[model samples]
Target: MSGISRRKFLTCTLVGAGATALSLKTTDAFASAKLEGYPDSMGVLVDLGRCVGCRSCEAACNREQHLPAPAQSFDDPSVFDQTFHNGQKRRTDEQAYTVVNRYEPTATDQPVYRKSQCNHCNEPACLTSCFVNAYTKTSEGAVIYNPNICVGCRNCMIACPFNMPAYSYSSATNPVIKKCIFCYDTRLKNGLPPACVEICPQQVMTFGHRKELIEIAHERIKARPDRYIDHLYGENEVGGTSWMYLAPAPFEEVGFDTTMNNEPIISNVKDFLGTVPMVLAIWPALFTGFHLLATRKHDIEQHGDDHSAHKEEEKKS
Candidate 1:
């Protein structure tokens, strides 16, 4: 449950006596440090096959976060019909932290609804890309935002591959980037499930330790292989995320970016930033040493020329 990949082949009963736990861990090119979040880092596993598109979670989120009253009521089912010009459905914005988008992979099959929100990546782009360092990955695995230091830069919005963060464009003076915070302030800090998780009537999502949830995700896949697509959405995405998913159809069908690299978004940023200190400390001395050697060579040549002239005068005497 600590995100540590075991090398030894150990037989473990997960679902039943017949089923076996597969020792499959995603390998990244960076071979970098594993951010298992905290030892007891909490996360949420969303079963997209079970979601009924009730928006109960959204209502619960609004109430828990004390957001402004929405234009549409919680009971409104018309929100499902919402669509954009490019055929993409609604996404998470300042008005809504979580949104249920309808997806129809095939013409004959029933519509599959997917919820979008902050995945809270273990190595978050928002946290690393922030010019003001506004975002934080908590020990509990909740990637929370601090508005006080936000500075309204919105670098997190640009850095987030999930496209989860939104800026409050309406606010002129004190605008800030807004998005799902995993209910860190009210419920999670108190060792309770998030309001959205608790309010989900269909039991579509479960909150627990991030690593434990990964096992549970695999167990669910093993238990019902036919129902699931066999691919876990957030398992290795951006170096794994706290909020993971199990879907009936491919993630690409549900409007997810499948071509993203396994490396954490900040891995490149770290590589670039990691060089700053090295360059600052090493380059000056290295270049200065080269300059000193060049000057010494010029001085030696000048001395040799002077010595040759003195010998010529001696020969003339």
Candidate 2:
């Protein structure tokens, strides 16, 4: 088989084994299963009203993450015009954990800038859909990945509604999915704001508890109705995201996915989850009934033979 196919097969096998391991019931069972994420986990609120698109956040991310130098400096405005094969703007990649893109709004006189990165969903699709226990949603609201255990199956990428999680395709042996981890290791652990947020000159991004950020975002919107969009981007989308947005124009005009459903990502997979219990509960009975029915003729024939023998024995008597 080709190398890619071979890797895919191995990934599938590993995923299957991991899933089986996870499915095994724990011996130390508890009465209640706690939900993921800490109650006081912090998040960031990006008010597009304040962002000047200076790319300081991008520069800080590059330095803090030790990513490769960009082809063009962060100060260069040409990056705003850069487009990929599909005419879509370039997003965060392995070299860049965060990126800012410019959007021109018809309703507004000036262009609005938006930053893109991991949204860190409350019910993260990446966490639920992962067959391997390679990803974790921390109490601090950061979705972290262990590259050592990752099989490079890229299911996390497929499952992510935000299209986050870029893979390191260039590496042959040690390739893995790469994305923003909310500066969990260096900054967030120390109770410091993320590198991007700290470096933001415009103070566009405010880091704090997600709950408080929601109220803060709304307060800003309410206070300056003319300066902000009426709705917060992550308030309901995908069961609410750790990273939220406040935009001036309708989110769609500035490249936000307005069509994203308010329901948690897991809700979309409930149909499959619902079928699983039914299959587990009904399979044995359904198969046993079929087996008994299939053997009924043979059982009846044996009974008839026994009856005939009894009649012969009676006749002899």
Candidate 3:
């Protein structure tokens, strides 16, 4: 019988296990036990009508995070003219944790400025996708990451539903995932608002408990139905986010992806995640058995060859 060495067996087993995990169907436990997040989690409510496209939040965020200087001054309005291929506006990157985008939807008479950052989902896909446990969801509704334990796999970048995570590709020796942490270390945990929120000249953002923010957002819409859109952008999107939006125009026209379902991104792959532990525990023993069987088969073949030679010697005698 053809035999496989222990090394080859282990390699093939790992590959097979990964493929199997990816193709698995959703399990009942994961489907049934959906996480709604902490009841008292803090959040931010952004009123787009109040935003003046000044980008004060961006400047404050940059200063607070001590990030690299930008290509243009934060006060420069020319940055609003910047657009990528297919007309995609600026997004978060290694240098900038937050960005304000200018969207001129036909429905609105004036330009609608939208601030973009990590939504800090209740059940983040990045947190679930990381095998190293590098991401954490704090009770304060902050989704923070640890660069020390990050393997630099870039899995978080691909797994993020909002495309918020960015890799520090410029660093040659050590690169890690970077994203907005809701100012957990500096301000949010200390019971103070984020730097961006505090610096907004127009008072565009309101910070408080998530549930309270939801009520406030609804109250604003109800009070001025003609001025604001009826829908709250992030209230139920992707299993509810720590940061929500109250836009004057349709969310889709303002660069918001309205088609995203309310279910958490992790729910789609929970079955795969659930089986990882089992694979780690069982595969070593199973492959060790394969190695033992292969070794025994090799010994049996050698013994048969020896017996055949002895019979031939007897015939010659």
lDDT of each: 0.81, 0.84, 0.89
| Candidate 2 residue runs with Cα over 4 Å from true position | 1-38, 293-317
> Per-residue lDDT tens digits of candidate 3, residues 59-119?
9999999999999999998988999989889999999999998999988889999999999
Q: Best candidate per TM-score, number?
A: 1
Off by over 4 Å in 3: 1-26, 275-317
Model 3 clash count equals 0
TM-score, predicted candidate 2 vs. hidden true structure: 0.81
Compare the candidates by lDDT and give the number of the best one: 3
TM-score per prediction, in order, is: 0.82, 0.81, 0.79
Note each model's CA RMSD in angstroms. Answer: 14.4, 11.8, 7.7
Instruction: Give the 10-residue window scoring lowest on summed lDDT in candidate 1.
Output: 18-27
The residue pairs that clash in candidate 1, if any, are: none
Q: Candidate 2 or 3, higher TM-score?
A: 2
Per-residue lDDT of candidate 2, residues 210-269 (tens digit): 989989998998899999879999878887889999998989999898889977777676
For residues 1-317, what per-residue lDDT tens digits would candidate 1 score against the true structure? 44322421121222222221111111232234656566788899999989888999889988988888888997788988888878668888788898888788762177788888899898899998888877889888899989888998878888999999988888989999999999999988899999999989999999999888999999999999888989888889888889999989888887789998888887766655655665676556655654655465577679989999999999999
State model 1's lDDT. 0.81
Task: Compute the lDDT for candidate 3.
Answer: 0.89
